[model samples]
Target: MVLPRSSSLKAFLVGAGLCGALLAQSAAQAAESSVWQDVQKAGVLRCGAAVAAPYVMRDAKTGDYSGYFVDLCRDFGEKVLKVKVSFVDTNWDNLVAGLQSNKWDLAMALNQTPERALAVAFTVPATDYQVSLLVNKDNPKLAEVKDDISALDKPDLTFAVMSGTAQDKAISSVIHSGKIMRLPGMDEARLAVMSKRADVLVDASDTNHLFALANPGWTREILPKPALAKQGVSFGVRRDISPADLEVLNIYLRQKRDTGDIQQLVDKASIEANAAK
Candidate 1:
């Protein structure tokens, strides 16, 4: 009922060869899991961007992207990864989605929050910022809200916030008495308060300062207390990225922080803001 010994030997060799092939395929698949390696192989780093001044910006004349965060990404490409850089523009609400969808390799200037951490991984903090408020200068009611940020939380008061942003969540947490106007962009949120369409804009302290510098007629207030949170800003990568890749980003940030590279940027932003004043 059995084949000859030679035929049996041939069958055994075939099964061993099949096992080796399967093992090789499994190893190859494992190697592909390291996203950093893939980036290296591609020789390009795609950065996801949602413009916010001092972080990301474009020159009107030259039409080039130049900001602290943009420059930092370029440094990472040249010094850390040895890759070329390209940018993909997105809105504040969709930056994370772009990274998760593989449209880009890194998400720039993301504020690390628990809700966001659930969807993406963050590098070590690049900077710290406070959640604050900006109110119309012409409003006679400003004095009442001056002593207490939460005083603006009244039925008649309205808050403007960029939709789907952390600031929106922050405002809703504490200002339950006021109505919120969700806007599509940061500029719109600031304008809502500036034009008196809304009473105040819940935003970052630095952002409000920049707005005040640009429009001397407008006034801004730093929230004596944050509604829900303050944010530590960082670059984001997909949750599935390799630990090695994360380490590379962290190391670069640490170097910048230790050398006062970040402080220099803060100083420059301050100078520019003051000049606008």
Candidate 2:
């Protein structure tokens, strides 16, 4: 009660600082809670889509989007969040960066990895993923290898992989001797193998399976005996997203997985992708 003027002034300043800090914390909380609400207000949920077969595919002539993840994005936007859905064309390398820059609300078909987790949040997996090799059936180099991918790790062999993808990293790590031709997209990598520019096309197992099915006579899928980069493929969101906002996505994914809708979408997309081929 008898404190000096300086003491009182110091106390007042301390109180003001605490109040300011509290106010800033409240504002951050409000911003986090409004994440989904912001999308609803915008009236459109923009999904960052990159073409990867059986997961995401874009039609060339019509410019239409398909695949299970695309369906999931549409379902979440229109049915769950009550907003229109739009696809923002991106490639694997840009998926995380686009999410970080707010270029899109979600990045489709992103494999959950420790490196990626540091930059973004992820919902429950929509499906599993593993890397595989798709080689021309007649490639004499692979004839003696069977499932041993290491056998193909020779300087004479060329491996084609989409740059910045999990498969690219996986193959690059193991195939020191082989030439890795990093392409811009899955289609380009596939083209490299089909056109004989590369001896092996490295991609997701599901994608390679579909590709081999579509070209049974020309392509053969090899699931490396030890596997490569096996992980859950999930939708990538901003790291700042609130737990509640992320739970909404997890609930939707759980429902889809339980009802077997996810598998159905996968089958449908595979059929369509093959038909187009």
Candidate 3:
């Protein structure tokens, strides 16, 4: 019952062709499902947002989100990706870790700092801002040193910083003698100071402004402008993001910057921030 030589050869050729076809199909699918492709298939982008003042805020009662970064994220999703937007609540302390863990696709309101760059990739900066100090009005220790920014770096003073932020790094670098109370978010940092648990809280300009607005006469600005302390605020993504996707986001931010749309958004957020207080 042995097959003839020519028939055996013909069957072998058919099997080889089928195998080749299957391999080709698999390769095509793999190409189609690149990370960006998966994003497309999902039809939604997951953006990470933290309650950093004027940038992002959630209404406790209504569960509605507002602020500059929220609007930016929604605009990016709808205008660029043509996808539905979903926001995940995250805090600065865990923001980059969440991105690396695939919890979210983008981290909004991230400031580009040398330390953060080691862990995550940043998009084009949406804006430039400066950091300032927010201190409780009743703190007597700050009264004498209020005139000088560096004078507050005393061993007795305690600074409340949101964990894993540039503010934390700044205090750690400049004020080795002081104690730092690492909090979860800006609100906690402000509360720590107001309650006399900490001497001061360092935050970005608008955020400090928000604290002032919320707690009238309770807090005041000290060292309102730190020398050469400007920071670039940008969105962050995983370090291994596809180059094409990063470029797409960079181009979008550039367009927003050039057209003054981002500034307009900031202006609107400022107004809204004041009203919220």
C-alpha TM-score for every candidate: 0.83, 0.90, 0.81
lDDT of 1 at 152: 72
RMSD of candidate 3 to the truth, in angstroms, is 6.4
- Sort all candidates by TM-score, best to worst: 2, 1, 3
Better of 1 and 3 by TM-score: 1
Highest TM-score scorer: 2
Q: Model 2 off-target regions past 4 Å?
A: 2-28, 31-33
Error of 3 at 158 (Å): 1.8
lDDT assessment of candidate 2? 0.91
Give candidate 1 regions above 4 Å deviation: 1-32, 60-63, 226-228, 269-277
Which residue pairs clash in candidate 3?
none
- Worst 10-residue stretch by lDDT in candidate 2? 27-36
Q: Candidate 2 residues 1-277, lDDT tens each?
A: 7765998989999999999999999998766655789899999999999898889999999999999999999999999889999999998888899999999999999999998999999999999999998888788877787788778899999999999998888888888988999999888888899899999999999889988888889888788878788899999999998888899899999999999999999999999989988
Per-residue CA lDDT of candidate 1, range 1-277, in tens?
8666997899999999999999999987786577767888999889998867677765546657766788888878877788898888787889999999999999988888898999999999998867778777677766556646567778888889988777777778877888999999777887888678888877777777777777776685656554446778999999987787789789989999999998897667556545633
Model 3 Cα lDDT, one tens digit per residue, 54-171 = 8888887987888888898899888878888888987778899999999998899888888789999999899887778888777788777654667887889998988877777766
Of the candidates shown, which would achieve the greatest lDDT relative to the real structure? Answer: 2
lDDT of each: 0.80, 0.91, 0.82
